[model samples]
Target: MQDALIVLVHGAGIGAVFALIGMSFNVVFNSSGILNFAQGNMLVLGGLFAFLVLPSSPGIGPWFVFLPASALLMAALLAVQGYLTLLPLRSSVEQHSWLITTLAASVIIGAVLLIFQGTAQQTVRSPFPSFWFLGTRVPAPYALSLLLALVWFGLLRWFHTRALTGLAISAIAQDLDAARAAGIRVHRLQILAFAISGLIVGSAGFVAAPVIAIANDSGVSYVLHGFVAAVIGGLGSDLGALVGGLLVGMISMYAAYTYGGEFQDAVSLALLVAVLMGRPEGLFGRPAARRV
Candidate 1:
């Protein structure tokens, strides 16, 4: 009974973590139609920053420092990435080429992390990045992750709802040509979306580690889940991503527990296949037209 209960708890926690990762991926894809594989590097960046900055200066208590600091840095890096990488390409050829570019970038960043940190594996090296938040028996790292996700999600919601840039982003997603006609700044908005997407996934990697440490190659799963979640929920719909992420999260949790984590990846792919066959448009995504 005890072991089963533990498994259940762990599964739920892991599910939440995965959901966050999925949401991050969806944000960028929905707005720009670009699939970013370099997102995991953001995770690596967060880890390095958290490992270094969180412990410096006035020394804010563990709970007060790591989350915000990591998020801020992640957001900044993502912003830079979007400005430099996507901004130039926004006016260029087919967006599909971005997939290849980002994949290559991810490879480069991963290599840099290994070289600088001398870590051949993808592990969070922060010595004491978290601490007891409310005296709860649960590890501080887990609690921190939950809090960070909620806070970041809320902030993202506000940006998407109340900000001019956010609205413009939506316009681009609905129809880029129309958006351009309306003076929506399509290219710039896409770049912004790219940054936002990277920020979400990148910070997620950082917080996710303390709660559930990952291997170096674990980034592959992160990227893959983000892709799957985007499909399951439907392209360009944040709500859809959230719903799809949660659904997939539950499935992954149970599958990992029942069939071992190794098969969990296969199960997720299976879910994707089933979803495609049952609803080709995704749970909420619209179907693409077939032109003669």
Candidate 2:
């Protein structure tokens, strides 16, 4: 029972990170109809930033400063990337240019990280102390990651429902052409969405860095699992991302416990395949309608 509880906590913590990445994907996809593949790399970059800027032993004050600074920096960078990615095409959905553009951006970011950070896995000592939970020594970062996920989810929900700009962003997601016709600045909103995505994943990466291995190549795995979570939850649903992330996290953890660590990815892949076969639209995703 204690073992199970430990797995649960660890799974939820790591799952929260995946959920943040999934939410980032949804944000970009919704606003621009383009999946900013660079998002995963951006998360890695966030951790790298934390590694570079943060002291070996940081206190709560350092984290408070790090969070907003990381968000702003990521937002600016992603917004610029979004602009470049969207500049060549009139309609993002109609043209497939983003596939290449975003991927190229991702590659460039990864390359840069590799050049500077190298292949060694980096880990920072957590400023917060570990606590015992039901005979398990639980790390503080795990609980903090889960808390951040829930807080971000609530904040996003409020933004979508209450904020005018967020409502406009949602309008663009629903019908780009209609939103443009309604005088909404679609392109601007798309850029904002990318920035918002950066804010989400960037802060997440920083907070969760203590638990996860930070390395240049780690982006690929993070993105892959995050994409799986997003697909499982439905592409545009934030709530779905949360649920999917937790589900994926728990399943993978359980698989590791039962079959061994190597089987974690395999189990996640199997779950993804099952979801695709049984419900392609995802648990919370509505079927998209097309006018022929």
Candidate 3:
């Protein structure tokens, strides 16, 4: 029973991180129709920013101070990258230029980190102190990650329903041509999406620092994991991201416990393959319809 509880708590924390990554992917895709393969690296950038901004002793001050700072920095940096990636290709004939451009941006970020920070892994201490729960030791960071995920989800839902800019984003996602014809600024909204995505994912990385170690090349693997979660949840569905993240997180934790840590990736791959083969549109994704 204790083992089961442990897995549950552990899986919930992991799910929170995956959910954040998946939602960030969904935001960029919905706004710009671009997958922004650099999503994971953006999280890495957030951690690095927090590392640089905070004093060596992080728990000494109000941790909330660093949160917005990292988030805003991430928002600015990623918005610029999004602009460069999208603006020039506004009239390009090639439909998939984003594939190369986003990947290139990711590579550049990784290279920059390597050149300056070296290949060593950096740790970010959690601001919250540890606590005991259900007769188990639960790190404050893990619990905080879960709380933040819920809050972020609610905030996003409200933004989509009540905010004018959010409505514009939804309109664009539904039909870009119609939205533009209606006098909506498509490019600007897309850039805003990128900025918002950065803020969310950057904060996720920052809060998750205590649990996940940061390294220059860690972004690629995270991208894959997050991508899998997004696919499972349906690429553009925010609700799907939440459910899918939790599902994937639990699956990963269980697999690691039952078989071994080595089987974690293998299990995830198999699940992804099964989903693609059976329901390419994903569990929540709507099947694409075209005029005959």
Across residues 211-240, which tens digit of lDDT does each residue of candidate 3 receive?
775778999977888888889888888777
Tens digits of per-residue lDDT for model 2 on 1-292? Answer: 8788889888988998899889999989988889777878888888877887789998888888988898889999999998999899899989999999988988998888789878898777668898988777878878888888898889888888899999998888899999999999988899999899989988988888787768777788888888998999999999989999998999999999989999999999999999989999998888999999
Best by lDDT: 2
Model 1: per-residue Cα lDDT over 1-292, one tens digit each: 5545545455445555555666676677667666667765666566556555544332336635566667666777666666666645744325566766778777877776666766554334333344432332345445555555566667767887898887777667667677788988766666667667656665666666555434345566666776687678776555566667656766776788788989787898999999989997789787767448
Q: Model 1: residues >4 Å from true position, as ranges?
A: 1-5, 55-63, 87-93, 120-138, 212-216, 288-292
Instruction: Write down the TM-score for model 3.
Output: 0.94
For each candidate in turn, the TM-score is 0.81, 0.97, 0.94
Clash number by candidate, in order: 1, 0, 0
Q: What are the Cα lDDT values of the candidates?
A: 0.64, 0.88, 0.82
Ranking the candidates on TM-score from highest down gives 2, 3, 1
- Candidate 1, residue 204: how far the Cα is off, in Å: 2.1
Q: Relative to the unseen true structure, what is the C-alpha lDDT of residue 183 in candidate 2, on a scale of 0 to 100?
A: 100
lDDT ranking from best candidate downward: 2, 3, 1
State how far residue 72 of model 1 sits from its true place (Å). Answer: 2.8
User: Lowest-lDDT window of 10 residues in candidate 1?
Assistant: 128-137
